[model samples]
Target: MPSPFPITLFAAPNTLCQTLTLTHERELSALKKAHSTELQTLVARIENTSLSTPNISTTSRTSRDLKRKREEKPDQDRAS
Candidate 1:
């Protein structure tokens, strides 16, 4: 199976200004449906994998350093 990344469709220079025939319209519709299904399946797999895994921590120690600085501000103001 191909990756679910976005795909671009290009029309020929001669066909660019021309109206699409019924066959071309059908083909375009089928391509769109296939792309949609692929995207849906990829998303489902990602969700299932995430659910099976443990939650990862995203917090940074920098926030703690910032909190410490804020706490020290009152002491500095008293010294002034």
Candidate 2:
């Protein structure tokens, strides 16, 4: 059936638009109900994994050692 309102963008309630809205709402509600438990379980697993894992240091130990060597090099040359 043609739209009751002159323009498609108009917000006026039409049978076709109302039917489509109800159908979409029912589909979304069913999907949420079906997946809600699965989504919660997945989230819990992710949180547990993150908490159990140890934190890693971002700075490189090798860089610090190299810097110490460089600082000592000039002092050794002056003494010799």
Candidate 3:
């Protein structure tokens, strides 16, 4: 039975090296493309989730302003 992976018996060392290098390059390219696709899919999912969800901010500007005013009132009274 013929081997699934057949290297030409007459192929020179340099030729064999070049063939292996080319095969590795093709495999690397394929892996990079797959990784990029997965990353893009994850980003799209995250964007969709964010869009569907409401902003749950820790503190709103209005609330922060009110808190700051309340805090500064004591300083103002002390200064008077």
Candidate 4:
């Protein structure tokens, strides 16, 4: 079966305004269809990229520092 894509054919010049208008509309429709497919592809890529990334959440520097310091400190008293 022939593909749905438009075929390039040479035709005599269309003199009627209505014929030219119809041709222009058809071309625009085909162009819109192509852009729609491209947009869908981009959207899928964006979705996949977002899904593949790690979800790790990071605390602020001060909170991380506090947590590390707390871990390093011991219960033993330093004073005599």
Instruction: Tell me the TM-score of model 2.
Output: 0.36
CA RMSD per model (angstroms): 16.4, 8.2, 8.5, 10.7
Q: Residue-wise lDDT of candidate 3 within 1-80, one digit each (tens)?
A: 99999867678899989999999999999999999999999999999999887666734766888999999999999999
Q: Candidate 3, after superposition: displacement of residue 73 in Å?
A: 28
Which structure is stronger by TM-score: 2 or 4? 4
- Residue 37 local lDDT, model 3: 100
Candidate 1 overall Cα lDDT vs. reference? 0.82
Model 4 lDDT tens row, 2-76: 879977646645646667899999999999999999999999999999788754453366678888788767533
Candidate 1, which segments miss by more than 4 Å at Cα?
A: 1-20, 58-80
* lDDT preference between candidates 2 and 3, better one: 3
Superposed Cα deviation of residue 1, candidate 2 (Å): 18
- Report model 4's TM-score to 2 decimal places: 0.52
- The alpha-carbon deviation from the true structure for residue 45 of candidate 4, after best TM-score superposition, in angstroms, is 0.2
User: Which residue pairs show collisions in model 1?
Assistant: none
Off by over 4 Å in 3: 1-9, 58-80
Clashing residue pairs for model 3: none
Error of 2 at 9 (Å): 25
Quote each prediction's TM-score. Answer: 0.46, 0.36, 0.60, 0.52
Among these predicted structures, which one has the highest lDDT? 3
Question: Which residue pairs show collisions in model 4?
Answer: none
Q: What is the Cα-based lDDT of residue 69 in candidate 4?
A: 82
